[model samples]
Every structure is written in C-alpha cells, then in structure tokens.
Target: MTRDRFSYLAPWWLPGGNAQTIWAARAARRHFGPAPRWQRSRWDTPDGDFIDVDEALHASAPQAPLLVLFHGLEGSSASQYAVAFADFAAAHGLAYAVPHFRGCSGEINHAPRAYHSGDFSEIDWILRRFAHENPSRPLLAVGVSLGGNALMRWAGEMEQSATQLVCAIAAVSSPLDLAAGGYAIGRGFNRVVYTRMFMGTMVPKALQKLEQHPGLFKREALLAARDLYEFDNLFTAPLHGFRDTVDYWTRASAKPVLHRIRVPALALNARNDPFVPAASLPTLQDAGPSVTLWQPAHGGHVGFPVSHGPFGLPGHVRAMPEAVGNWLLAQL
Candidate 1:
C-alpha cells in the first residue's frame, strides 16, 4: 500500500481543516468553470425506487475511459467536487457520470430505505450496470466522504470480482471508520455546524419518507433528533435493516473490509478532516496490498485548493479530482 504526501498542498492562506472544507463547499463554486450541460437519465431501482444520473459524455479518443463519481452525504451531482471532476473529464477527454444517491436527486425516493454509509449493494448495482452497458470502456470510480466509504465497501465485498467491473477506485476523504466519524460529527463544533446543516435537509426528507410510508418511523423521535446518531437510529438504521445507530455504524463501516479489496484502491483523507478523526484511519498493515493510503498532511475533507487558480485567486480546488483521476489512469 502507498502512503505519505502524494502531491497535494493546501494553499498557505487556508491552513486549517474547517477553512479548507468550508471554502471547498461554499466559495470554490465561483472558481469552477461553467457547469456541464448534463444529459440526465433516471434508472429504476430493483426495489421500485429511482436514482438520477447526470452524464457528461465525451470520448476524446475511441473507447476512452469513463469516471463514475459518487457524491458525499446529502450531496448530489451538482456538488462542487462533482462539477470539478466533470470539468476535469471534459478537459481530459473522458466520460464522467455522477449517480445521485436515492433521494439526493431532486425527487424523493419510493422506498422506505434511504442511502447510508455502507450502502455497498447500491454501489454494486450501479457500477455493474455501467460496466454491462459500456463493455468496451474501462470504468473508474471516485467516491467522496460517505460515497467513498460505500464504494470501498462494495470493492471489498466483491473482492476479486470487483476488478472485473472497474479498472481502479479512488475514495476521497472517506469516513472508513463509521463509528469514529459518526461519533466525531455528533460532538462540539462538528455537531453545531455540520450536523445542524445536514439535519436541516435530512429531517424534512425523512419526514417526507414517513409520509410516503406510514409508520416507517416515529415522527416525534425524528423531530427530536439533534444529531446524526439520533436521526440514524430513528430512520436510517431501521429502514435499512440495522438494529440501531451502533449496529448500523458497526456493520456498515468499510474499514473492516479493506483487506478484501483486490483491485487498485486509493483511500485519501486529510489528517485534519473534522468529521473523520485522524486516529481512526487504518495503518499500512491494516489493508490489502491493492490499497494505497494517501493521507496527505493537508487537504481538508476533499478540499485540496492550490495556492492559486489560473484565474489567480485563492482556493482553486480541482487538484484533488485531477490528481486522483491521473492516479487511476496510471493503473491502466
């Protein structure tokens, strides 16, 4: 497994984790190029639910590789990272698709179940379908945060079989240790900031889910939820077959399954990521040889802004996607 600083430096102006993360989410939008004109397609799930996929299809060369991006929690294809990667794919002559997690798309899903950190079955279904559709093209995947963990779980779960579906996988800023990350996000600044922001959308959507499926969960308990733990216990866990938050976090974590991955996998995280405790990250010995641990000293929570962009303002953050994309291609 590869480790150490592998070419990402946070701009000197933005040194802390929150600064990089917050800027990446908020301000980096202005720096990105025009958003791609997406070719949207809806695919019905096996459970009669649906997911929307935004595709930026361009083959600079015949059968150029396709990069599939999985967005973070409460995120969609319109996320800054997704746009950045889309811009990168266009510039480099590759096909890119961002498959929205059920409910992350504009519409609410039909199922009682929603996406979770260890939703590997969802990943398996999506990627395999992509591979089946484009048999001649190589498949590459990059997952951010929650998406990353889930993607990693699918890779480990599939083991050698995963290699047949994708050329390589890069998981950016994944909370591999769900228990640690979940716990961390429930406390102090993270709880006040991130947890609150997430709940703003999550609670309402969950309520909508409850409306769709009567008695899916307790409305009072869901409303009382002040953190992810409580919300997960009330909704995510029960709907997805987990006993509770603890059970869900324990069983869904990708860290335990890392040793099973057979294809080239990159687990990239910032030591200072607020949501993922640095101590929770796996050691070199903990994973299979196919895994590469790129724990850069900086680059907070998928935020890898350079000192300047071509526009010459600070907080240019596409470097993360580009570096990972190049790394994935190198494996081929």
Candidate 2:
C-alpha cells in the first residue's frame, strides 16, 4: 500500500474537523453546484425488494468509462456528494450511476429487510450486471461512509475475483471498524447531534416498515431506541440474522477483511472524522499490497473543502469528489 498517494489540503476558513464536516453539509450552498439530469432505473432484487439507480450519461461516448457510486447512510442520489460526482463524471465524459440503498429510493421497499453496513449482495449484483451489460466500458466504483464500508467489505470478500469486474475501487470516510465508529458516534455532541439526526430518519423508516408488515418488527422496542447501537440491536441485528449488535459489528467491519482485497483500491479517512476514530484505520503494513490508505489530517469524514484559489477566484469547491474522480481517471 502506498502512503504518499493522497494529500488533502483544506480551505483556510474551515480549520477544524467539525467545522469542515458541518460547513460542507450545513453552510456551504454552492458545494452541490448545478444539479445534473439523471435517468432513473429500477432493479428488482432477488428478495423481491427493489434498488433504484440514478444514471447520468456522457454526451457522446458509447464505450465511455462508467463510475458506480454508493451513497452514505440515509442519503440518496440527491445527496450533495453524489450530485457533485455525477456532475464531475458528466463534465469528464464518463458515465455515472448512483445506486440508492433499499428504502432510500423515494419508495418504500416491499420486503421488511433493508440495507445494512455488511449487506454486500445488492452492490455485488449491481457490479456483475453492469459488467455483463457493458462489457466494452471499463468500470470503476466509489462509496461514501456506510456505503464505503460495504463496498470495501465486498471487494475484500471477492478478493482476486473483483479485478475481473472492476478496474479500481475507492472508499471515503468508511467506518472500517463498526464497533469503534458506533462508540464514537454515541458519545457527547456526536450522540446528541449526529446520532439524533440519523435516528430521526431511521426510526421513522423502521416504524413505517413495521406498519407495512405486521409482526416483522417490535414496535415498542424500536420506538424506545434513541441511538444507532440501540436501533441496530433492536432491529438491524435480528433482521439481518446476527445474534446481537456486537456480533453484527464484528462480522460487518471492513477492517478485518481489508487485507484480502486484491483489486487496486483506495481507502480515505480523516483523522478527525466524528463518525470514525483514527484507531479503526489500518497501518501501511497491515494493508493489502493493492490497497492504498489515505489518512488526511483534516478532511473531516467525507468533507474536503478547498478554497476558491488565490485572490478568492472561483474554483472547484467539491474537493473530495474531484480528488476521487482524478484518482480513478488515473487508474483507467
């Protein structure tokens, strides 16, 4: 694994980790830039649920490279990062697709089962389908946050087999160790703010699913849950067939399987990311030969805010996606 491959420089205004992370999502308006026109495709899963993919095509290339994106938890194709990447792909004449996780595609899934950190079946299916359907175009993939974890896990699980399908893979702000990440997000302000934000959407969705499918979820227990750990313990674990939260986290964490990844892969994490601790990251020695770990000092989760260049001239604001797109382009 290479150590000097990635170096991130943040904007002068955004100093700390929290500032960079929060500002990108809350304060920065232009970060999303102009929205791209997308064509929606519905894919039917084997379990009867459906996954929605929003595709943005290149202007004139039948065999242009394709980039498949996986969004973070509770995020959809409309997410700022996803849109930024879609726009980047379009501008660079590359085809892009953002796959929405189960129950996140603006329509509630039919089955009670939804996506989790370790649920790699959907992504695997999507990659295989794309490879089969678009044999002429080279394929690349990127994932953010929870989606990143799942992508890395899937790549590692596939090992040497993944090189046949994907040319390269990149993951941003992935919680490699689920337990540490869960604990980090459950403490102090992160618990009060981020955890609440996550639960605000998660609890309602779980309740809605329960309402749709009676006897599938324990309403009382789910209602009482206030954080991710509790929610996962009550719903995510049991629904996914894990014995408990610890078991789920242990088996789902990508850290253990990272060394098994054989395809050219990059894992980017910020040292001060609120959702994941630095301890969760793998050292260069521990990483697979094909994997590169980019631990920037101040990216703050998936946020890598760049300045508008010297003299405050207008420049690219989406640093993370731009960097990722550049890296993937180089790989191709």
lDDT of 1 by residue, 88-139 (tens): 8888888889999999998998988889999999999999899988887899
Clashes of 2: 0
Q: Report residue 312 deviation for candidate 2 (angstroms).
A: 5.0
At residue 133, candidate 2 shows an lDDT of 81
The superposed Cα distance between candidate 2 and the true structure at residue 231, in angstroms, equals 0.4
Candidate 2 on 106-178: residue-level lDDT in tens?
8888887788998877779989988988899999999999999999999999999999999999999999899
- Where model 2 places Cα greater than 4 Å from the true spot, the runs are 29-34, 57-60, 309-317
Best by TM-score: 1
Worst 10 residues of 2 by lDDT: 26-35
lDDT to native, each model: 0.89, 0.84
lDDT of 2 at 1: 67
